[model samples]
Target: MRTLLSNIKVQVNPKIYIKDPETSVLGRKIIQESIILIDEIGFDSFTFKKLGDRIGSNESSVYRYFENKHKLLVYLSSWYWSWMEYRIVFATANIADPSEKLRKAITLVTEKIEDDATTDYIDESVLNRIIIAEFTKTFLTKEVDLENKEGFFLIYKRVVNRIVDIITEISPDFPFPKSFASGIVEGSLHQHFIKDHFKTITDCNDDVSPTDFYLHLATFITKQP
Candidate 1:
């Protein structure tokens, strides 16, 4: 109970709960704190024991809420993707013009990627690389059997398909398939995640930010014949 309240204190405002907040249900608090601690410390360093310690609980107590660290990470990842999907859906909903929708899609996604608050959870650079690698392995592979891929890939698949839909709408006249155009968008997005590495292999001026790269790419895609 002590641990649960401790976590809530960190993640949520105390004014919301008036009395006996410290003795609240354990399950809600553990997950809440797990998320908070993970965001503060990051996945690589975040452990059940560490979380428990921070929350004034034991490792065993933490396990009662999450079976393991991987389980917690899966939950966190799902949470993030859910937020991503919501924003993507909301951003594209009203835009009837395919070109505008495509640009908005790119802009919204890039903004999410560049969001500074997210840095509290994980190093954006590392997080982007991990996301891209997982996306490629789970959704971008030659394997068509969705059942064969891990469950984590499902969220990525949905996001990619959303992008594909927008691309198809914008480039109905383009020669390539929908998936091919989607792949281009996905590849460019992934590249923005780790654009720093590209500088080592090729010349990138110091002034070139990921947003700059994305704008150029967006313009190029918009002007596609």
Candidate 2:
């Protein structure tokens, strides 16, 4: 994975940003600090003004990169999905067993994140928390149709598609490869949310890790008739 991260720059949808945030120092700061601010205060309470202050830039400067906070959220969500897909590819590259590949993918998606020093600008651990907490806000809007048409969610769809291909390889006769793959991704995220905020909503035991639960769920779904 370290080799993959050596020179990696996750490309996000251009439509989500007013300008490419990866192109300039201030732009990168806006992205890096915005992720931290959003994770600290969440989407509803987060503002570009607040993010500007955190990064020692004004709101207008930040606005040059993103049209609004919503666009920033979309950009972050796209970046997260791209990064996750990279991890999936790197982790599964050497393994020939489809089941093992699936298990590795599931574990990567469900397990806790730690900041990678290789990507010094972004704290992936904090970004993962933001994804678990507020990723739905990226698409659960009236403009979803327009955004979908603009390919705002392409990285996410690509991630799901990659997993679906893996599932098809493992179980060629599986009837709902896309459905099961998407369910594993979303269900793992929601289960984490439930465990964190509404404990009673989930049946996961105190002893069971999220990785274990998701791996079991993925295996069961893929093997089912």
Top of the candidates by TM-score? 2
Clashes per prediction?
0, 0
Weakest 10 consecutive residues of candidate 1 by summed lDDT: 9-18
Cα-based lDDT for every prediction: 0.54, 0.87
Candidate 2 Cα misplacement greater than 4 A, ranges: 221-225
TM-score to native of every candidate shown: 0.61, 0.95
Where does candidate 1 stray beyond 4 Å? 1-32, 39-42, 112-150, 173-207
User: For candidate 2, lDDT tens digit of each residue in 59-103?
Assistant: 899989888888999999999999999989999999998888999
Report the Cα lDDT for candidate 1. 0.54
**Residue-level error in angstroms, candidate 1, position 148:** 5.9
Q: Give the candidate number with the greatest lDDT.
A: 2
Candidate 1: tens digits of C-alpha lDDT, residues 1-225: 223322322222222222222345665566567656655665668787887787787888766555566545544444445545666676678888877887776665554354334223333443444444343432333543543344544565566678777766766665654555455446555665455555564322456644455666666556777
lDDT of 2 at 64: 91
